[model samples]
Target: MTDQRANWTDEKDATWMTEMIYQVVVLGKRANSGFKKESWQAASSKLNIEHRVNYTKVQLKTRNAEMKKQYAQVSQMNSVLESQRSDACG
Candidate 1:
């Protein structure tokens, strides 16, 4: 829950989640793809990889510019972890 991205029962992250859901919905809409059950399931899988595992760095940042601060924090942490992993291996 409190691994890094704060994917727990917190207000900030919960807000982020709500924003993300709306984003995925918007993405589907813009693509002219209806939010069918299967499509949503697939998109959810792709978006939640990092949060669910609290390990993966990949994620779909929302288009909401107001959320850039929160998104930036996550992006920074991911890059740092990636750099550390590279160092440990090489």
Candidate 2:
């Protein structure tokens, strides 16, 4: 159990796992035609059958807003940490 815990807590291993998951999701989204399709014909065909385009658009916009907020928070965190490090070193 201690060995397993040590292995799981490895930073390099966690970073690799995070990168793998990100790559998988990025590739999967790229492979999805509905998200990438731009033609009215293709979009209409898919949305006409499913009536999900508007909802999906709304969801995407909401997600974009949330991501922006998260990015701002992370940037602020980095700024604070950098300032703290500078003050400590100085």
Q: Write the per-residue lDDT of candidate 1 for residues 1-90, one digit (tens) a residue.
A: 223553433543454455446655665433454234443344445445634533222222322333667789999999999999999999
Q: Each model's TM-score?
A: 0.30, 0.41
44, model 2: CA deviation in Å?
12
Give the winner by lDDT: 1
Candidate 2, run of 10 with poorest lDDT = 1-10
Q: For model 2, what is the error of residue 3's alpha carbon versus the real structure, in angstroms, after optimal superposition? A: 46
Model 1: CA > 4 A from native: 1-66
lDDT by residue (tens digit), candidate 2, 23-62: 4465542335333323222323343244322324333334
